[model samples]
Target: ETVIYRIYYYINRSGTGHLTLRELKRGNLIDAMLHCDEEEDINKVLRYFSYEHFYVIYCKFWELDTDHDFLIDKENLIRYGNHALTYRIVDRIFSQVPRKFTSKVEGNMGYEDFVYFILAEEDKSSEPSLEYWFKCIDLDGNGVLTRNEMQFFYEEQLHRMECMAQEPVLFEDILCQMIDMIKPQLVKTDYFTCLTIEISCLQDESYIMLRDLKGSKLSGSVFNILFNLNKFMAFETRDPFLIRQERENPTLTEWDRFAHREYIRLSMEDDVEDASNGSAEVWDESLEAPF
Candidate 1:
């Protein structure tokens, strides 16, 4: 780690021993590492840096910054979408987790906060990213999610599902689905009742919750995707402007893997359809025309 740090210090070029968010946005991290002394190829560890991932993230931050203030306010996000998906994204982003205080408004996010948010959103299984989300969802900053906070987002989703469904889906059914995925140890439902969500997915209710898990977090992005994900499928329909997940080695998140599996599934489906169609055509034209 020390050797890598030394190499990174020189690669920083700013002589500050740290790579600023601006430095990342401007160009690729590996490109900078390549310029390092040719004697040792520091770029070998490029996979560890997530050079491309950070670039995409920086670009996204720039896009959403809108006013160029290097920050995103709730107004800007709400304008991003008035729908349930947007509401949940906004809710999680502005959760009561403590920050350095970039905005006085209820839920504004600066670049640093945005970076973690994107990371967790991109990779649900990441322990670190999960923790970042947990902080946001833990509105009371009590290290656990309360009923009010969870319902605030769930209710919006309920209204949304209702509009899209041919039939009404009770909150309990949704909870059951969510419980299967999130598997919150203590199942508290009744819609109006305060909900307490432990971050872990353990089946045992008496077991330790996610908050108690070392380096644990629960981001809204992951929850939204998981809640709607059907087996290996989860469409990122919530955020139209959501940043594309970078596929660099070691950077592939659970979502990425799932998407890849889904892609294979689709490809197989297409192949089967084409084969069936070809067989039908062959049978139909079993006898050639007079020519």
Candidate 2:
């Protein structure tokens, strides 16, 4: 079933204020859980969903809302349902454990325990992948990365070409510089990808352009904050005139402005013309610009 139906209908209809085994059963958790023929597959799905819930909450806190309203959003509701469904499946699989297998039995575990278990599992799985990168950077087949090796690599490859470009000596300064470089790159890449996708779908080009202009203005506002970090963050200080100029001035040239003004003047020459074109979209203000 689609996430929308699961969130909007099944879970909501279950009327459970919080997720429980009973609620999970009523939510039709079995259908949502992916088919797993092995014990490892069951564990993987359980850990994956638990991690997903934690990550979703983390992202919502960091990027969307700190007050927890993100939990109420439709997207988050779907995510919560998915995780809850996975948890139910894992619980069911554990329920099948024989009474004789006392050592393998997991006692009544709450959501928090499940979350922590997922995190531990992820940390264990990540170690082997990092080992490969460690080996590649070890250079002399040394078992570990050394200070001298790291310094040599940094100076030879990572150093700036400009002699005036000094390395950031402080950890906080280095972190801030890294954020400055990374944030804009992420934004630009996202913006370009979104534009490409929208264009590919044959969306209205003019509307897309307007949306892009709005996004550019928002980005400029964000840039102003980074540029003037020492100043107080204020919403009302943005220059409206500069924003308007940026939006409209790109398409206007001296000749176009002149001709546009003439066309508007001709259209509004008399009351008869204005009455006849009452429903028409007017472009008088755009035409009257001084260029």
Candidate 3:
């Protein structure tokens, strides 16, 4: 038995009476039905009424068991068509939903998931830089961050170093500044204790002596220097002496007390200014304060 299915589409335009699919295809439709003031106006109407509607009808026909209506089960046709139509309507509605609302829905997930995902994908071959540390700290795969994991890692590393050595060297203020520069999102949390420990471990000579410290401690200001200098040096292309000289010049304008302290202040500032306002230029160590 061959089933012949007739698919009908109807379009309602304001100027003319209702237009049927047959009338449209045959060019027998009234002048008012064909009359569109602009090409865009006609295209929009055709897209929604003819093209999209035809696609929906075709999908429904494809899902049917037979082509002949007489041989087809009436109840099954109604059920399948109605189900597909319902889903299509739902997709259209969701597509139109505002982005702000969608983001709010997605934002409820745990931050740990976000950080972990990022860490898992990180490239190990690249230099073990701050970005590498960042990938590790992001325990969850999500791009947005939370402070607990990062602070815990930093604190644990600091504690390990402190346990090896008896005294502190890194200044609390300098540690806070480093946190601000390295992980701004994590800096917002009340986990400054770990940051303080990291700075102390880095600065204290006695602590380094306890572990048989092998690396230079005073290469750069605490705020500007990376904790893993060895990793940075591995990939750096510049001359080692030039880099060392830059760090050695205590009188350099950028290393000045105000430069270092001001950098810290800018990172901690709650009300962020626009980029156009220009960040305080890197500090000059040589500029003497009037005081």
TM-scores of the candidates in the order shown: 0.49, 0.18, 0.21
The Cα error of candidate 1 at residue 218, in Å, is: 11
lDDT of 3 by residue, 139-249 (tens): 443332233433433343344337657343344443454444333222223225344334433333212110111122322222112222222233233568645755787
Order of the predicted models by TM-score, top scorer first: 1, 3, 2
Candidate 3 residue spans exceeding 4 A from truth: 1-132, 169-175, 180-242, 245-291
Q: Is candidate 2 or candidate 3 better by TM-score?
A: 3
Instruction: Compose the digit string of candidate 2's lDDT tens values, residues 198-230.
Output: 332232121112222223323222221221111
lDDT of 1 by residue, 1-291 (tens): 322332332244453547877756654555545544342543233333423333344545555667766568766655431222346646556663523344554456766555445445556555554565556555566445544555555565556556667244455554444444454544444222434433432233322234443323323333553232221123423333223443243465563443344446555755887878755223224422111
Candidate 1: 10-residue stretch with minimal lDDT: 225-234
Candidate 2: clashing pairs of residues:
none
Model 2, position 268, has a per-residue lDDT of: 54
Error of 1 at 281 (Å): 50
Candidate with the greatest TM-score versus the true structure? 1
In angstroms, the error of model 1 at 126 is 1.4
Ranking by lDDT: 1, 2, 3
Candidate 1, after superposition: displacement of residue 6 in Å? Answer: 17
Question: What C-alpha lDDT do the candidate models reach, one value each?
Answer: 0.46, 0.31, 0.30
